[model samples]
Target: MAPSKTVAPANASAANVLSSVVNSYIDKTPQRTKLIDAFLGFLVLTGVLQFVYCVVAGNYPFNAFLAGFSATVGQFVLTVSLRMQSNTENKGAFEAVSPERAFADYIFGSLILHFFCINFIN
Candidate 1:
């Protein structure tokens, strides 16, 4: 009789290990947290720079450009707000705002952007 072969699931174990590593690092290091903050800030700045570049380029549909830009920027700002509230080191002034509310704000801003876009597109 031949012996049966056995395969082990690796992804679950890897995820568990990764989660533990992240949790331990966050618990232990302030530097990691600050680096994360700086990276996010840089992302926001890059977004703003792109928007400025779009403005300087002068596309045919300014409204459409603005609509897309607003949506992107609004979502970014909303997420940043969420992180601010969730982060242990910094207590955001708008900490009371929940994810749902921030999401709603993003959606509302998107709607307003599109509203202006359609009229301006024509």
Candidate 2:
């Protein structure tokens, strides 16, 4: 008797498929986008570290924890917005807005976030 062979579907999802997709995406993505991704990742890591510290040492100063975490989160959000605004592909969507304007908005937002964080900390 001959052994039967099974064929996989063309669209079959494999364990390594995600890695391949991510690799391809990274390869094709612009350098600016990659930089933004790295920055966002750093912000997230900082926030995570702050949380871990608070947990380990106890949130003795809850306001300080909130200030640090909020600052990280706020920076991440503002940076993401800057990325979106500065993206060439998104230029059409933001036809009325310029890169300079986006940067200004980022600075303004950061100032506000910093003010609140400082107030909360105190």
Candidate 2 C-alpha error for residue 6, in Å: 3.5
Choose the strongest candidate by lDDT: 2
Worst 10 contiguous positions by lDDT, candidate 1? 82-91
Q: What lDDT tens digits, residue by residue, belong to model 2 across residues 1-122?
A: 88988977656656469779899878888987898899999999999999999989899989999999999999999999999999988999999999899999999999999999999998
- Evaluated against the true structure, the overall lDDT of model 1 is 0.66
lDDT of 1 by residue, 1-122 (tens): 89988856798889889999989877875664566567567768867876887868876767667666665566566556645654555546666776466557756865775576566656
lDDT of each candidate versus the true structure: 0.66, 0.91
Candidate 1: deviation at residue 3, Å? 88
| Clash-forming residue pairs, model 2 | none
